[model samples]
Target: MLIRDLPEDVVMEILSRLPVESLMRFKCVNKAWYFLIRNPDFIAKHLFWATSEKRHRGLLLNREHEITRTPWVSLHSNETLEVSRYVDLLQFFPRDVGELVVFGPCNGILCLFGVPADRNGPRDGLVLWNPATRESKALPIIQRPAEMPTTFPFRFGFGLDPKTGDLKVIRILNLNFRRCQVEVYNLSTDSWRVINTSVNPIYRINSPRFPSYLNGVHYWLACERGGPDHWLMLSFDMSNEVFQEIALPSLTERPSFEAVAVINDSVALILAYNDLATRFYYICVMNESGEEKTWTLMFTIGPLLHFTRLIELRDDGFVLLRNKNGWLVLYDPITQEQRELPIYGDSFQVVSYTETLVMLNGSGECA
Candidate 1:
């Protein structure tokens, strides 16, 4: 009647339901259990259960120390929003302020890099990390391909390659010539290669902080180059590495700010307009199941009620908001309850993550 005596499928079902920390320790119990836990199919199933059940969900927070200015990355429980673990990003990069960890949670893999101490310093090495298993793979610094110098920070996104199921890091540099020079780092090959730039859309990937990668595609609120002042959702399919653009809802006047995020496994467009009275957020979710993509307006959160901006959206109807005077708040519309989060620091970075053994020992096929 022991777990080991159970049928293979039954054991897997029971083990998959357990938390990642327990499964990690269970791996050494026996050779058969070790192999079973490491199997790609088993890992994917466990990840599916974790995500669907919302059991191992955590929020990654990137912030700097208020007194020392030291950069730190921590994982907090999604339910409690309390810090569970801390990894100083300074250890990953030599620079003072490491880049925000917003690039991922793609199959529990994150792209980590350094922000130059100033605008002129060189970037440090890039690393792919899985906080769940505490394993990381560091890549060589990608050298700038363009001969012309530019001051813009290299925009990077991390996602799963749908075809190969391998992890990939996308580095995009919008050159002055209105073209994007793209390089992709494939984790399976552990190398970086430049993809063709001729076919890339001329739209500039809008923001560095809030770009979202859901499933096998990366989403960004982009601006078309040399065209009308229309906003577009620029998406790159990781499987084919093809660029596609989805137009946003045309407005009589441009929004003061635009951002994109993945909510409920769909891309959401957020347009914020500041008027004389207060700021308003136009929230829309894009539906792609049809022959052509369509946008649906979801909500219009507004009137600047204490919270100045929307930071995170949860499936359970909780909205994370931020104050203009430095406070993190959460709003539950159903209960009409508002509470401030204990987390603090400047330039806060938050991403939802479901713990998985994807990058255990920094090698495996990601889910």
Candidate 2:
């Protein structure tokens, strides 16, 4: 059948089934395809299809950085695989020597902002990267006219601002030494502008963790305008560049670790705390009131459960990197299952994950 003979909606349906990686590369096929893929409606449709198809996708795990053994392993079948076997989808950085620390992944893109390699430059930097396609674009620097206070705690967020057709990076800089200021970067104009908020709030670090992106707004937990210790949640509207606060469920005391996760397609907070004896977790679904309903107790690690690190995996569950009998076991709380993913590196650190992508620090052993 000729290309023009196909119905427009049917053609779009076929295109939407293709993975984002393939669609991105096919943009070069023609000007029409390029414009179609770049359209906001098409992007939303593509994301919906991708998420719907991935609800039951099998897990692919890798054993990274093995000196005497292979570099990758898959968890789905309880088998070890070679990293070189999937080089097309897997990219490795043997070492990362930059200050652009990454905090979270959003819509398959990772948010990163520049830090000094060695404190040589006058300004900090920012960028958003898509590792699957190896595509990244650096953000323009947003500067404050005066020197920022020493106690300033800053958080960065990136998303598309639909109103202006510009991708924006919102920076929340909390200045305890002085009043804090809100700054934003517009990718289209490559400029930073300071925005004024109605009531200045003291940023809260111990409250709920912020989601990467939601409804063109980035949310953060902050101190209420009433007092220093009183906690509140703040949302930055990317398009309007305005700040608004959301109310959350009333708790007797704040949680130690920020409870944040993507639950049921919505950003939910995983409220958790641990005393010396035991660990307790509450999975709370967030609503417009900032209140959490449907409170569910997820897990409790007894006093004897000694884990060195806990990382939330791409599968909506988390892995506990802990030692059991001198062997590292990756524990899944959801399934109450554990597998020995032997560690072989001297100082092991996880860089990131893409699908089943795993990259170890040095030498690691896996079963």
RMSD from true fold, candidate 1? 3.0
- Could you report the Cα RMSD, in angstroms, for every candidate shown? 3.0, 8.4
Query: By how many angstroms RMSD does model 2 differ from the true structure?
Result: 8.4
**Which residue ranges in model 2 land beyond 4 Å of their true spot?**
1-9, 24-44, 55-98, 142-146, 149-153, 162-166, 199-201, 204-210, 223-229, 252-255, 289-307, 313-330, 342-367
Query: 1-367 in candidate 2: lDDT tens per residue?
Result: 9765798788778887675557767778888887776666776677667656652122223333345332342323212321222322122221222333453444445555444433444455565555544455556654544566422446766666767656677676666524666677765666777788653644553322333456677666555544754655566678777777666666776664354544445655555566665554555656544333343344443232434333332344544344534345566666667776644432222323232111111121111
Give one digit per residue, the lDDT tens place, for model 1 in 103-161.
Answer: 77787677777665554665556877777877776687767655646445676777888
Which candidate wins on TM-score? 1
C-alpha lDDT of candidate 1 relative to the true structure = 0.74
